[model samples]
Target: MSRNLDLDLIRTFVAVADSGSMTVAANLLHMTQGAVSQQVKRLEDVLDCLLFVRKTRKLELSREGEAFLVKARQLLRLNDEIWADMTGQPLRGALRVGVPYDLVTRLAPAMKAFAEAHPHVDISLVCAASPELSDAVDSGHVDVSLLEYVASEAAGEVVGIEPLVWVNGRGSDAWRKRPLPLSMVDEHCAFRQVVLGALADKGIAWRTVFESGNIEATAATVRAGLAITAWLASTVPVGVEMLTPEATGLPALPAFAICLRFPATVQPAAQEFARYARESMANEPGTRRAQLANIA
Candidate 1:
């Protein structure tokens, strides 16, 4: 006789896979880490297949686990739809969300999911730099904001930690230039400050080659092999290659926290949207850092 998979266990497993850490999954589910571990173990026992390879700081999916993840997501989506049909009230309202320009692509999936789930809700997405997003959250310009903070100074729930990397045009050694050519979004960009400070500390002379608040322009400069710039590991565009500290003799930059911030007055719609963002960050494979390894 075949045993049926427990929905609760599956839910826990998805959370763990999405967040890449048991502790984070536990926090998201409001369960103890031990409880989350037991749930995963129980699920593995039921399937007779190991799901996750536990590591020092994160969980990596085993071959079987990777195969299961797709089906698991389908199951959860079906379950949510059924439950919503039975019990979910009509969620209708306008919600303003602030996000960093760099993260718009990363957050698109969650935003799309939320829009589809609630057809009547109007979502106004505002894209800006992290500091502006934070200010928007504080001043009630947005119901929720996703902001990047220096890892040590971050306060909100951390959805992800991204390594700051130096990137230049693919196959280009522009970083070797004396007084390194630099491109930046703006003076207020957190990455800019970090990069500048790291350069200063290393006594590495550098000159600004380009400065623009437009991500596209900055990217263009980098892609044209005109300069090197600092970017998060995951957000590096396709045309650029990451320059390793060992190769470039540049100081390693610190990680940054990707966090969700909420205003004091959060509507139900906003809250629900926030939940979707959190879940998306947890579940999206690209956001998962299986190991705290530095990006080379």
Candidate 2:
């Protein structure tokens, strides 16, 4: 006979892994620390293995636990998707969301699914660079904002990570120039400073060949073999080819994070959207973990 695994236990385990602290997980789950511990212990007992390494204050998943996490997230995503489809809680309100251009496509499916589920709710998407998105969040202009940052500096609930890579038009050797031609969307583009800093550290000479607030213009320039550009690997334009470190001899770029931010007082719709965002990104390639995206 097969015994069913409890979703509650799997959820608790994932929260602990995402948080790296039972205390933080407890807060996110709105449970007492001891209660969270009991849930974790119960799950481990059922599985017959230690799920966490408790040798230090900093919590880590055991090897078996790591393998279990991927499946757990998939389970939770399916559950949540089904729950939303069934109109759980039936939320109805207006929600404004700030999204960086890079994540606009990735975020679309969740938004569509949510809108279909809650026809009464209104969602307005504000497309902007990450900096502007943060300002929107701080000013309460948007109920939720998705921002990108150098992974080390990312704040709030980080849902996804992808490499920052150099790209050139197909068959273009634009990156080989003595003073490389770079295409940038704007000064405020999330990749700006880190990309420059990476090149500087390698002593690579570079000059801007194109700069625009419109990404289409920047992509057009790069696609025409006019310049090389840096992008999150997943978001690189179709006509460009990723310039590998081995091929370009350029310094390796740091990975960037897709993070969710909300005002201190989060709207209910914002919380729901955050959950869908986290689930959607978890299903995407290169995201580190499945998360709850709790507004902390």
Candidate 3:
């Protein structure tokens, strides 16, 4: 006797594997937890194996579930590929993309050009911090993202890198002093670690006088001469001067990387958008200038 399995059951199974919780998977699939549980049970019955083990606060994957997840991801990917091929659509659909705030000024214009080139596609641009943006992409809330690549979770190809320079209000000499008072993003920021890490490595003293999570506020604090702070060269607000050792006597951070991430299941139009991002960023004058300035 042959048994037929439901595709919805398989989808629920994959969502549960990805989310690690029935409630979260239910939210993703827009189904109730009971429905999700029933589907998982149906899936298990068809496969005749236990899939997940519920612990105190989380669901742990059994060895069988672990193997099943790999297969589920492959099946979903194959299905998407097959569906896309069969339809032969131009990928005209709403695409939501997550980008870090700083890239608005640096890369938004190029993205606008991409949108103009593909007028049929509706695009939604969400500006967020790197970690938040990455989370959005990982959770399938956004099609693609541009974010920083820290030593932790350094998974994607390097898309852009620039020196993180100390910037201060024009004519401010605070950066020239030892144990600088700094303006910085709050604890949740990706660059907060980068800044603190670099200072700790050099054994430099710093006091965080301002901890606004907003980049604009951090830059404004620096511009008002309240504190000196590190900034990516491309996104540094105009009129604030980059601190050189001649001016600040502090060693410069030579390079920090930015990256683009998309699911292995990203759609064709999304891939087209990513290609545009890669190509436009490759020709970015700001990035080029920063690299040259760092060398010189």
**Top TM-score prediction, candidate number:** 1
Q: Give lDDT tens digits, candidate 3, residues 175-204.
A: 755677888776666677777777888788
lDDT of 2 by residue, 1-296 (tens): 99889988887887777557888777666789999999999999999998899756768889988778778766765776677668757778899989987678778888988888778899999998998887677556788888998998775667987688888899987889879899998888888988899889999889999888788898999999999998877676577787778866988888889988765345667777888888877675433222111100
Best-to-worst ranking by lDDT = 1, 2, 3
Residue ranges of candidate 2 with Cα displaced over 4 Å: 1-89, 285-296
Q: Higher-lDDT candidate among 2 and 3?
A: 2
Predicted structure 1: lDDT: 0.80
User: For candidate 3, what is the lDDT?
Assistant: 0.73
Clashing pairs in 3: none
The CA lDDT of each predicted structure is 0.80, 0.80, 0.73
lDDT of 1 by residue, 1-296 (tens): 77677888988887777557787778667789999999999999988999999888778889999889778756655665566557768988889988887788778988999999899999999988888877676556788788898998774457777788888999777888888999998777868778888999999999999888788899999999999998877777778888888877889999898987665344567667877888876664543353235473
**Per TM-score, what order, best first?**
1, 2, 3
Query: TM-scores of all models?
Result: 0.68, 0.66, 0.65
